[model samples]
Target: MSEPHVHASHPDIARRPRRAEGQLRKVIEMTEAGRNCLDIAQQLQAVESAVAGAKRTPVQDHLDHCLEHAVGAMSRDQRQSIDAFKAITKYL
Candidate 1:
């Protein structure tokens, strides 16, 4: 198999999900310990926000670098696919 492609923002973006994972573990622990609902909800929200930030980092990097820097060399079909990807990532 070919090597996997890594984005330029990989290192920075990777930290986010790890933070979210840690937040998630805390949330799970809080739940098991019968912590206040609101506190657990708050930690869950933190996890969600961390995950969203992680997701946005790479999408923003793609727009800033991949599409912006490589657009001129891409064929029309390739451009269309990139457009489609941009449309899809907006929901991230």
Candidate 2:
């Protein structure tokens, strides 16, 4: 079996989602308490933005580290696959 590859630790990456989770919990509580519509909407937007940032960070890190490091060495098939993945992540 192949060994697993280890990436560098990114504390900031973990922080984004943890903060978003707290924001989400607060939004839930606000909803339960019948908070103002505008306030709830604003908080919900912030949560969504935080979640998106959390996702984007790791993907960007992977591209910056894993894929970039391998660019000159990868086979044509591997390059194509990575390019396809990069294109698809645009929707994220």
Top model by lDDT, which number? 1
Per-residue lDDT tens digits of candidate 2, residues 46-82? 8998888878878877886887787767878878877
Tens digit of per-residue lDDT, candidate 1, span 1-92? 99886876899898999999999999999999999999999999999999999888887787867677766677787788777887777787
Which candidate wins on TM-score? 1
Q: List the global CA lDDT of all models.
A: 0.87, 0.83
Error of 2 at 86 (Å): 7.1
TM-score of 2: 0.69
**For model 1, how big is the CA root-mean-square deviation?**
4.3
Model 2 RMSD, rounded to 1 decimal: 4.3
Report the Cα lDDT for residue 35, model 1.
100
Error of 2 at 61 (Å): 0.7
